[model samples]
Target: MQVNTSNDVKIYNLSAGRSQPAWISERKRRQMERADVNLRRRIQLIQDFEMPEVSQGIKVSPDGQYVMASGAYKPRMRCYDTAEMSMKFERCTDSEIVRFLILSEDYSKMICLQNDRYVEFHAQYGKYYRIRIPRFGRDMVYQPELCHLNLVGASNEVYRLNLEEGKFMESLQSSFATEINSCDINPLHQLLMTGSSNGYVEAWDPRSGKSEGVISCDIPDLISNGSGLSVTKLKFRDALNLAVGTSTGHILLYDIRSPKPYYIKDHNYSLPIKAIEFILEGDLIASMDSKILKLWERETGKPVTSIEPGTDLNDLCIVPDSGLIFMANEAPKILSYFVPSLGPAPKWCAFLDSLTEELEETAESAIYDDYKFLTADELDKLGLSDLIGTNLLRAYMHGFFVDARLYKKAKSIVEPFNYEDYRSHKIKEKLQAEQSESRVKVDKLPKVNTALAKKFLEASTNMDGKAKKKARMVDGNPLEDARFGDLFKNPAFEIDPTTEEYRLINPLVSKIEKRRKAKESHAEEEDVEKGEKEEPTELPDLEENGRRGEQEGSSDSSDDDREWVAERRKVHRTIRDEEYMERQTRRARKLLMVDPNRRGKVTEVETGTVPLISGRGVNKANVKPLGARLDEEEKQRGGAEEVQLAGGNRQMTFSLQSKGYERGREASAKHAMERKSVHRSSRGIGTKIKKPWKGKK
Candidate 1:
């Protein structure tokens, strides 16, 4: 019964007349303009149709091309075209169509229950059949996939009627003891859900004739008369969500996987819901007693809007593809409204229109607070903290900060502060600080020039006086000095491919070869000395050999003494025998072994005699070998070849036939390919002329 009052209130009071102030008139003009802007964007009445009779049910076709309605009192039905807005067909029968009409997918045929006793079917053009039923059907649903019409009877029984055969197949007994009031089928999942009068809802698998699950509505709040509330309507919003409407005006939504409903809502009018449906976008629409239609956003459980058409609505239908709502009532007029799909508006043009009153209230509050400043916390609560300094002032001056100037200013302030770069820089600084703290610093020492020290060491180490004098005489020769100086000046710097390779004089080569020979001679002499040191000695030392022999004799005597003592113990220990000792350990309880022939046997009365035996047996001489006995038993049991022959023969025959078939197919394929190749060769130029030379001649 709750309705949106947006249409009842006015923004400005223009009725203050011509004597009102200028500001009042201006305000009234603005309000009128705003109202004019919003009227075209919202839900609005498009057209209405006058029913020829009292309509009991209204439904739109799946393709949204036709609207069908069945009359309440008379057995009459009519179909209308949605695009053309004209009646396509109409028919009247001997029995009333009742409150339900099911149409085939192609709309070529229709079926309806008549007086809970018979079902009337109508085909294209004009063909009809009335079939009798054993039980009174309270509710019926048609499953297109199975091509069957499922009926729930007053006796809590479910029956399937084949549409093509036009006969009742059989009945499935429900577990519920009370009568079922409503039933629906989920075409996608092929499931049947039935609701009983005692608020028990059970999902049935028609194929198995067994209940899939049962939903208990026995909660204390939803129960009445020491039982559960009556289920007036049961509908599936989708394959997974079920919407159950009760006579108490409570709509409970349950997920098929759980026992409890995830959402519950009350209409508050306490009237039986006539029809419940979910639109293509998942919003719920419910109409009760034809007085009001409620639209709810399924996720929020909040009413989007409520429309009162001033008539008792009996049924509702929505054309999902066209976004149009159709409602039928007791009144002759059938109302239709066109509403756009619900979502965020592409352009919210009515922003100022919605905020005029809110702005006025805030202005009044501001005057009382004397324009006090808002703290940082308060600004954050208002979600304006990002607009800290100049940006906040700009928003106040411009009424709202949507201008390009404000956007650029804010972007300039935020563009330089990238979170990743700041974090990386802080990490680098932390690592450097930690490394500095872990290591100790000391003053650096100056380097010493080693060129003079190197020359002094060389002069002192190579003090061959006679060799130096001869080298000085050789250096006196201009040719020799020039050659020797070039080689010795920088023997390491031999060649630079870019510059040294193009030199005019090559004195460094000969001097370098002489120095190389001298180095080789020195290396050869050092190797000879190492070989002599590595050679083994040819003679042994007498004193060392004498000491080694004395040590070996002393060790051998100690080993001999220990061996004698061990031998003596082995010889004497046999005379001292000791009893074997057993250690006890904890284990599970067990009984000790008992002798089988502990009591003496009686020999007075010869009941049995043994021929010759060393064991306990009455007829020991006649005992047979185990192997011979097992061989005799095997002869009686026989082989398993007979049991396995049937299966093995069939398998071998199948494999042989399959192999032969494959070989035949391959042979045929080879013959076909050979014929094709011969045909192509005969058509070629080489084969076209039987004798090329003869044809030319």
Candidate 2:
């Protein structure tokens, strides 16, 4: 009888109830100093329109309090506030939504697309501004100072409208030859960058109405090497260098001065990549496909971090002020930032950021190598995984994912499960999915089309960039992107005005953890729990094969000839000696494929077909052919289509066959094992020998 025993004696807390690190980047001193920093922000489940399908359009008020949500089947634009689930106005008299819903700089007016491509900029207070532009509406954008709504589409043109007269002021021409996909006006400069279906990225000074430069596909000109890749999005890293995303899931970094782009990033394996955002000052770029949000070092072209932002990410945008980010998904769940007190923000984050310029600059010069993340073993010992989900081990494999924004988001997402004793087995499916370590690395991936990138970025957040008059407003423009002041004072969530209950609270899934008082009580409870006997359900032991599959007594004879025992021993010895004498051309047998001439299948061969073989074995396999077909013996067969040869006697015993001794001896021994049999006597023992199947003639 065998005894079942296990030496396993370790405990792990893979639950949300477990304690997180005090702060990811050593915030002990800072937190201690600012006790009031503990307040967390969350969504309040604002107005949810019955638009169960999808929202094709969205326009938020300048204050971010009122929103206009529309879709293909949706009736008009449903307007409401984030502080309540109640909605008021439905601008029902409208058309299909192809372009975005543009709210005026003051949030008092909105412009929308009609079925026939006519636009109506309706004022929230009184009047409506209408315009008839000749083009398919691809995108609609606006500027405050110009008081003009730029409509981009089949034809590239900017229609200037006078607010007071409600009439066209001037018509400006654009340089695109083909249909324009999308366009954006720079907040700092009047320069506009647009993409087209012909793989062309054209930039223009919208004020001067001239082209800055254009990037054309050089490959499409060649007949044989033509690639049908088209430009998807284009954005400016600066005035000279623009980032372009192509349909091939590649990012081309182009400088207007050079004819060719400097580099291309094809990292997502052509998975229809979604978006890329420079964070922590542009040092890091966050790009997302359907499943993961990957962080890449913009300069080094290496993946720095990643996260599973809960759903299919439709958009990604960074809030440099609070380090908060909004990952717009199909469901539109907002994401928050949780910066480590010590880690650096992205490279571009420094140059492009409004706050933490000092830290961003220092972070640039500082070296970031020696730091290490906590391993699964240590996390288990510290009892942290249980609270965060054992999936954390898998989630964190791409290095620590928290990019300053992660903390705030994670704090909200993880808080509901706090103090709960959840089993790691329950969320296993989700972990295996979103948090698996088998994630392929993206050295450098192309950017998404800037138009799509901007749409997503804008849709994800309420960051409205309107250059207003400098006055008492904080940061000069109160509603634009936040400055350093907001990070310390403003939290993300606004308490719902209606219920006043915690709408952000997640539904409870697991049981609460038991509180312990003394060590004695814990031991007694463990003993009591152990005493409650129950048979564990049967499960297949998959790991058993690794230890037990090896057979101990199997004979090592040739697979075809088990009966010829004597010949097997002699051949094994000869082959072993011959292998050492043979000189190999290269080391390691070239992994799974090998050829003496060092070539792999240049031409594909059909599977399951019987290949023609000669006495030389495979054409490439036979490194040293055994030489010479017996033409004399073949002629003796009377030139038949096929000849049969018998090998019963190699020698009728005559000398002088010049080194034929070995073959003769082998032939003799082969005949002996063919008919060996055994029978048992009175003592009762039985033995029998099997023969190698009749040898080839």
Superposed by TM-score, candidate 1 places the C-alpha of residue 135 at a distance from the truth, in angstroms, of 3.0
Worst 10 residues of 1 by lDDT: 361-370
- What TM-score does model 2 achieve against the real structure? 0.39
lDDT tens digits by residue: candidate 2, 386-487? 645433333444333223333345455555565443556557766786443334223221132323234323332332234222333334222234442343
Name the regions of candidate 1 deviating beyond 4 angstroms: 1-48, 223-228, 282-290, 341-697
Highest lDDT model number? 1
In terms of lDDT, model 2 sits at 0.48
Q: What TM-score goes with each of the models?
A: 0.42, 0.39
Scored against the true structure, residue 94 in model 2 reaches a CA lDDT of 53
TM-score of 1: 0.42
The local lDDT score (0 to 100) that residue 439 gets in candidate 2 is 43
| Minimal lDDT window, size 10, model 2 | 9-18
